[model samples]
Target chain A: MQTGSLEHISDNNGPIIEVQDLVKKFGSFVANDHLNFTVSRGEIFGFLGANGAGKTTAMRILCGLSSPTSGNATIAGFNVYTQTEKIKRNIGYMSQKFSLYDDLTVWENFRFYGGIYGLKTEKIRERTEELLGRLGLQGEKNKILKEIPLGWKQKLAFSVAVIHQPKIVFLDEPTGGVDPITRRQFWEMIHETAKEGITVFVTTHYMDEAEYCDRVSIMVDGKIVALDTPLKLKETYRAASMEDVFLKLARAK
Target chain B: MLLPGSGSATLEGYDVVKDFRKIRDILGYMPGKFSLYQDLTVEENLRFFAGIFKTTPEANYDLVKEIYSQIEPFKTRRAGKLSGGMKQKLALSCALIHKPEVLILDEPTTGVDAVSRKEFWDMLDRLKRKGITILVSTPYMDEAMRCDRVALIQAGKIMDINTPEGIIKNFSSRLWSVRTNDTYELLLDLRRFKATRSAFLFGQHIHLTLVDNAGSEPEIRKFLEDCGHQSVEIEETRPTIEDCFMDLMKG
Candidate 1:
C-alpha cells in the first residue's frame, strides 16, 4: 500500500533498464538479435511479439534468469551478466503459467513468496492482511488458491509480485483468459502500481492492451521491427488500431 | 452416468442425459488446457486421439490437412517440446481428426500471440466453411466480432446472446471518449463529476456515459477545465463490443 520508499538500491533519475546490441545464441541459432532499448523510471513498457519471436529470450536476459551470449544490459543499475544475483534481488517476475501455488491457501502463498523475497515475518503478515483487505478477499484468505476464480487469482498474483516493492516488475501475459471487466480493472491496478514509481515491463497478446502502454516495442523474427508510442506507431503504419499495426509488421515478408 | 445439475441440455438434437454416448461420438472437444500425453510424439498423439473415435488419421486426413501440415515437420518431436503455437495446431488437428459434426474449443487463443491467434481464427473460418458447427470461447472481446453470434457469460450466467453488431447496437447510451494529459487523474475527476453515470478506461481514452444522457460535451469539458486539467480531447465515438460488454456486466 505504501509507495516510493524503496529507492536506495538504484539512482532514482536514471533509466531503470538499459540494453544495447543484446544477442542470445544457442548452437548457431540466434534467439535475440541485436536488441537495444531503455526503460525509464516508472514507465509502462510493452514488449510484444509473436510466439517464438525472441521476446521471451530478451526478457530472460533482462530479468537475470538466463545469461545472454553477447550484450550490454543493466537492470535496476546492476549488470545482467556480472551482477545477476543483485539483479534478481531487485526485480520481480510473474508469468501466466506459474506465479502462485495452486494447492496452498491464499495467506500461505503470500507468506511463502514473501519468505522467498527475504521479508521479515511481521512485515509479511502485515502486508498480507493489507493486500487481502484491499482486494476484498479478507474472508477468502483461508480458502485454497485453486478454488478462487481465475480473475481473483490473477489479481492476487500481481499483488504478491509487488509485495517486495521491487524496482521493476516483469509480467508475462498477466491478463490472459480474464474477463472484460476484470481485465480493465487489472490495468487500473497496473496504473496505480506505476504511479507508485514501479516500472512495469509487460508482454500481452491483446493489442488493445498495447495502447495502454506509454511506449511499445514490436518484435518479429528475433528483431525489433518497430518501437514507439502507440499513437505514433498507428500513424506511421497508417493503421486504425494496434492490431492492424501488428498484423502489418508481422506479416510483412 | 448421473445428472448433476438442474438444467437439461442437448447436443446436435441428442438429449445430453439420455444420449450422452451418442453425442460423444459426434462431438470433438479441445479443452483450454493441452490434454494430450506430453511424452508422446506429435504423430503418436494424433493417432491415439483418432483411435479413440474408432477411426484412423488417414480416414479423415483431408479435414486436418491444412493445420497438420504446419506441424508435420515436428511429427517425431514430443508433444511437450513443441512451442505454444505448434501445440495448439496439433491439438486442433487431433480434435478434427475424428470428423465430428460439432467441435467445441475452450479459450483456444488465450495465451497465443496475436499473429498466431489471427491464423487460428482463419483456420476456424475455413472449418466453418466446411459445415462444421464450431463452438469456441475466447476471453478477447475483439474475437467476439469474428463470430456470427456471441453469448456473453459472467459468473456462470449468460448475460446476452446476439451478433456482435447487434450487441453494439443495443448499447443505447451515448458513449463519449474523453482524453486528457493525465489519464488516471482524468478517470478520478470524471467519476467525481455530477452527471457522470459510468466511466472506465478504454485504452488511452476513458469511455464515459452520462446520467440519463443529460451531460453535453461542452458541459463535461468545462467541468474538466475547472478541475485544472488541460489538453482535453472529447469525441463521440461508436461503442465497441468490449464497451457493450462492460455496460451489460454493470447492469
Candidate 2:
C-alpha cells in the first residue's frame, strides 16, 4: 500500500515554471482561462489536452511569443511580458515540422542554427561532434536532411534546438507519426537530455508519452482541470490509462 | 494497394492477379492521405466519387447520411481548407458513397489528433456493425487491442495472426513493471543488469523484459535499490499488445 508517486504532488517547490491565473483572449474568445501550474527543474512535464484546448496558447505565453490578456507567467525566472528576449535565449523549441533545412547537409544545418544562437565557431564544432557521436550519426555529417530517415532528422532537430544549451526545451508533439521503435528511441533521447539537467516541457497526444513525464497537467476548454503525476491522475479518475482519464475529463465537461 | 511478391496473392476468395477487376468492385479503398479534389467543395468531391461508381449522390444518400451529416455544414468549402478531422470525415463519407461491402483504411489516423482518432475508430465500429468486413492497417501497436483479430506483419512477412489476447498469450517471457523516481538513471542501471533483455518506459513505469523466466526479479530489484533509489518497485506485470509485438519482433 506504500505508493511513492501514487500521491498528488501538492508540495509545489523548486518551480522552474510558475503560472498565476494565466488568461489569453483573441477578441471575445478566451483561449486560456485562468491557467495555473508549475514545472520543477529537470522534470519532463507533459502538457495534455484535446485539440484546440488552449495548450498552444499557454505554451506561447510561456515561450514569450504571445502576450496574455490577463494574469501572468514566468519562464526561467524571466517575466513573460518584459523579459521575452531573455526567456527566448534560455529556452529551446522543437515543433512538429522539426524546422531543419531539407536542402542543407546535417553539418550545414547545425552550423546555421549554431550561428543564429550566437555560438562561437569552436563551440559549434565541439557540440556538433559530441552530438553526432551521441546520436550515432557521426558518419552522417555530409548527408542531406531530407535523405536521412525521419527518426534521425527528428533527433537532429532536437539537438539543433538545444545547441545553445538552453535551460528548458519545449517539444510540441514530436513523436506523433513515428512507429513504436522510433518513439522509444526518441523517448530515450529525452531521458538522456533530462539526465543532463535540462527541463523538458512537452505536449503530446499519445498517452504513453504522458506516462513518461515526471508530472502532467491536462487542459480542458482553456483551463487546467487535472494536474498530477500520471499514476496519481489515473488513480484519482479511477481510469486504467491516461487516454481513459483524458476521455473521462474531456467528456465530463 | 498492390504488393509485389514471388507468388500470386488472394483477395476475398479471389486470386488478386486474376480477379483484380472483380475484387475492385467490392472494395472501398481509401488512401491514407486525403486524395480528394483539393479545389472541389465537399459536396462536389462526394458527387464526383459517386459518378465514378456509376451512381448519383442522391441514390446513395442513405448510405452516407450518418457521416455526411457531421461534415454537411462545410458542404461549400473547398476540401483543401478543411481541418484534419473534417477531412477525415469527408474522406470516410466519400468512401461510403460507393456502398462497397469491404472497407480498407490504411492508417487513417496517422496525423490526426487523439480525439479525432477515437472518433474515427468509433465510426469504423458503427460501419462494422452494418455487416461490412473492415480491414484496417495501423502502425500503432496500442491499437492492436481494439481489433477482434490482428495480423502482425513486418517487412512483407506475417509474424503472427490471431486475436489480440491470443498474441499476448504467446508472450512467454516475463515482463516487469520497474518504477523509480529517476527514469534516466533507472534505464542506464537496468541496461547494465545481466538478466535484463529490454527496458523501455511505458507511461510512468519502465517495462522490463527479463532474459530468463521468474528468476531475475529479486536480483534486478536489489540492483535498483543499490543504486540509491528509495522507492524502486519491481513487480511482475502482464504484457500489453505492444510488449507482445516487441517480443514477436525479436525472433
Candidate 3:
C-alpha cells in the first residue's frame, strides 16, 4: 500500500541531527555502542527499542544533557559536546514525569516557564494567550493543574515546552497512559507543530504510535539495528507490522 | 490488598512460609524501577529476595535456569543503574525466586520501549504455559486484550471485569463508520440527527452509533445530503475493546 508523503517539511537544506559512532558507558557497561543516525528538519523521528536498549542514553547525549563517552552528535549546526548551552537554548524538552505545580493555574504555569526562559512579560502574555487559545484552553487559564484531566495536562505540557518556540521538541513518552482518542488528538497537535517547521523526536512504547512517525530508529542492546520509515522497517524484517518487526529483532538478541 | 466490597476479612488457606509466602514464590513482580539496592550486585539482589522467601536460587535452579541465562551478563552490575529492560528482567527473577503459585504485576511495561514491551509479554506467555497464575494490570487497551481476564478501572472503580472478547461483545450499539470530505460538518450534522445516539472521531472517519438501528443506508445517505454532506462513505463494523470501554464510561 502506498502511503501519502508528508508535506510542509522544513526546508531540508541540511540535516538537523547528525550522529556517528556514539558510545556511552558506566565503568565497564556500555550503554550505547557505535550508534549512528540522522533526523531531517520538520520530521517526527521515533527513537524506539526495548527497555534498557540505550535509546534514552542516546537521546540524552544528543540533547546535551549527558556527555557521550565517545563519538559525535550535531544538532541544528551545533556540536552537542562543545555547543551544549546553545543546543539547550534552541531545544524544548518534555520529560516523562514533567512537573506542573499543582497549586499553579494553567496560565500561571505558562508564565512561570516563560519567566524562567527570560521572555518579556508582554511576549509571554501574548504567546501564552495565543497558545492556550489555539489549544482550546483559553477558558481553562485559571483551572488548577491538579484538577485538569491527564489528557489536558499532556497538551498543556507540550504547550509549555514550546512556549519559547524552539526549533526542536523532544517528548519522552508524551502519551503513556492516555486514552486512544486523546492520543489521536495529541498527534494531530504534533503534526500541526511539525507543519510550523519544528522537529519532533519522541520515545514511546506504543507500536501503533511508531506508525505515525516520519521515520524511526530501533535500538537493541546498545546499537541502532534498524533505521527507516515504519513501512520499510516492516518490509526489511519481513514482518506484518511494526510490532512484529520489533519483536523479531528484540527476541533475536 | 483490601478490596472494597469483597466482604472478605482476611486471606485464608495460605501459609506464610508454605502457602501465604508461596504466593510470592513462583510469582514475578517487576516494578518500573528495579528497586534492588544500588550498592548490591545483581547476584546479591537475587539472593536477597530468595532469602526473604527462605529459598536460594539454587533450590529452584531448574525453573530459574532459563531466566538466569537471559540476565547472566549483568549479574555483577549494581541494580541502581541497570538498564530499563535489565532491571525488569532482574526484578522478575527476584519475584519468582520462591516459586509462587500466582504472579501479580502492576504496570510492568509502563516505561519500557515498544520492543521490550513485546518481549516482556512474550516472557509472560512462557510463564503462563508453566501453569503459573499471572495477573497483570495496564492502562493500555492493546495490552488489555492480551490478558486472560482484565479489570478495567477508572477513578478507583472497577468498570468491568471479563475476557477481552467478552467486553467487546458487551458493547451496546450498532457501530457505523462514516467518512466524508468534511468530517467536522459531518460530526455536527450527525449529532443533530434523531437516529444518531453518539458520534465521535476515530482516525480519518467518524464512528456513529445508531440510537435505534432504524435507518438504512439510503435513508442515511438522504439525511446526510439534506444536511449538506458530500460523497460520504458509510460501513457497519464491530466495536473494538476501546469502543466498549468508552461505552461503559458513557453509561
Off by over 4 Å in 1: A1-12, B1-3
Return the TM-score for chain B, candidate 1. 0.97
Q: For residues B1-251, what per-residue lDDT tens digits would candidate 1 score against the true structure?
A: 46848878888899989899999899888999999889999999999999999899999999999999999999999999999999999999998999999999999999998888989999999999999999999988889999999998887889999999999999999999999877777888999999999998877789999999897999999999999888899999999999999999998
Tens-digit lDDT track of model 2 for B87-186: 8889988888878888988888775656767877887888888888989988777777789999987666899999999999998888899887766668
Q: Which interface RMSD values do the candidates have, in the order shown?
A: 5.5, 4.1, 4.8
Give residue B186's lDDT in candidate 2 (0 to 100): 80
**In DockQ, how does model 3 score against the reference complex?**
0.31
Taken over the whole model, the C-alpha lDDT of each candidate is: 0.89, 0.83, 0.79
Give one digit per residue, the lDDT tens place, for model 1 in A1-87: 111122222345678999999999989989998999888888888999999899888988998889989889999899999999999
- What is chain B's TM-score across the candidates, in the order shown? 0.97, 0.94, 0.78
If scored against the real structure, what TM-score would every candidate get? 0.94, 0.88, 0.80
**Candidate 3 per-residue C-alpha lDDT over B1-251 given as tens digits, one digit per residue, 9 for 90 to 100:** 22345443222345434354444444466564447677888899889988988889899776666776688788888888676667777888888888876777877877776666766788889888887788787767777888888887766789999999999888868888887755545766888988887776554467788777668777778899998877779999888787787777666
Q: Model 2: clashing residue pairs?
A: A211-B203
Deviation in angstroms for A120 in model 3?
1.7
Clashes of each: 0, 1, 7
Q: Count backbone overlaps in model 3.
A: 7
lDDT of 2 by residue, A139-222 (tens): 999998889977788889999988998989999988876767778888888877876778899998888778788778998889
